[model samples]
Target: MTRTSRRWAIAAAAFLAAPVLAGCAAGFDATTVKHYSPTEARATTVRGIQISQGFVLGPEPGGKLPKGGSAPVYLSLTNIEQQDDQLVGVAVNNAGTVKLAAPIVLPRDKRVSTSGAAAPGATPTAGTAGPPLVIEGLTKELAGGEYIAMSLQFANAGAVDLTLPVVARSREFATWAPAPAPTTQQTPTTGPTPAATATPVPTATATLTATEDASTGGH
Candidate 1:
């Protein structure tokens, strides 16, 4: 074939393949349906203590967290001030008491978080940092996509009020641990067992015979 004819044939083949590739791409779209955002967690600045990425891990998808149960919370704290601070407690109205796995100490200009990583370039302290905060003894059942009012109590920073979202245990939070279910302790049944009734024993009577003496006399 002539060079001109060969070039035209190659162009025709390339033009024909373009529509097929486009159709394949259209059929299998690579766009994601869900996305992870830092804003999904609540963030607020209280005095010099900045709390970020705060959210309670709610029930599994389409499930309800039972009353008197517990839920786990994740949050990051940054101490922007010069002094250190301690997170002593957290309170949720009509929800539950916040339980800290360990004492959380926020060093000056450093970060500590329950999500493991404290900040962008900071590592959590070995023994004294990075403890999970949990809500125990929930007063009411909770579903996902709900909001609850919470208060964080600090040793020096005082208390900070927050409204945190209850994120479901699916998608980005699927890997995070949920709060342990409440265990029911069975109480021992008490009462004295009825004593077995005692039975009466009959006494046997002994009979004595004197006729043997008369036979001996006859002999």
Candidate 2:
């Protein structure tokens, strides 16, 4: 079967159309995750697609932490082959995200993803396990030498060992800008109104009321 056909078939078989799992609850095997470095990251054939260049993120912009907070980690990927390959699917810790790519991996979750680090949330039931974590979302995108590092994961891919790479993504392909600082503005005091001051009194009468009024007048 073709790449797209293969993905649709797998998605139909495994997922039941739920939002992708996210947060620390993605349930990655801690042992397996500790070993996938770019230098040693290996690829395996699912159907016929070869997956490689795996890396785990320290923290994403908004993903929940192990015991601290949340930061959405961008899962980076690359196709080592000269031919343009198709990303069939992903199953990162049972989490999923609808991708924006033909072989997609952006926005981070689709279909269904695990929630957070063993928090008081629901989790997918365990079935037959696959060696070397294979996490996939929707779609796929990669060019030889050119890599895609976004929030999406791959279906039949990831590192054999989980020591994911800590490389930062280049700005050449970032689509969003960081949030800007808020601007502060203060209203200026109208010390003396031009119209009021301009109309000067022709004469003044000395009186107790005048003194009291003058004392109460603003500077």
Q: Which candidate achieves the best TM-score against the true structure?
A: 1
Q: Determine the backbone clash count of candidate 2.
A: 55
Best by the lDDT measure: 1
- Local accuracy of candidate 2 as per-residue lDDT tens digits, 59-87: 22222223221112222234443344334
Error of 1 at 177 (Å): 1.1
Off by over 4 Å in 2: 1-36, 60-85, 95-219
lDDT of each: 0.74, 0.32
lDDT of 1 by residue, 1-70 (tens): 9999999999999999997776666533221222334455787888999876788888777788888888
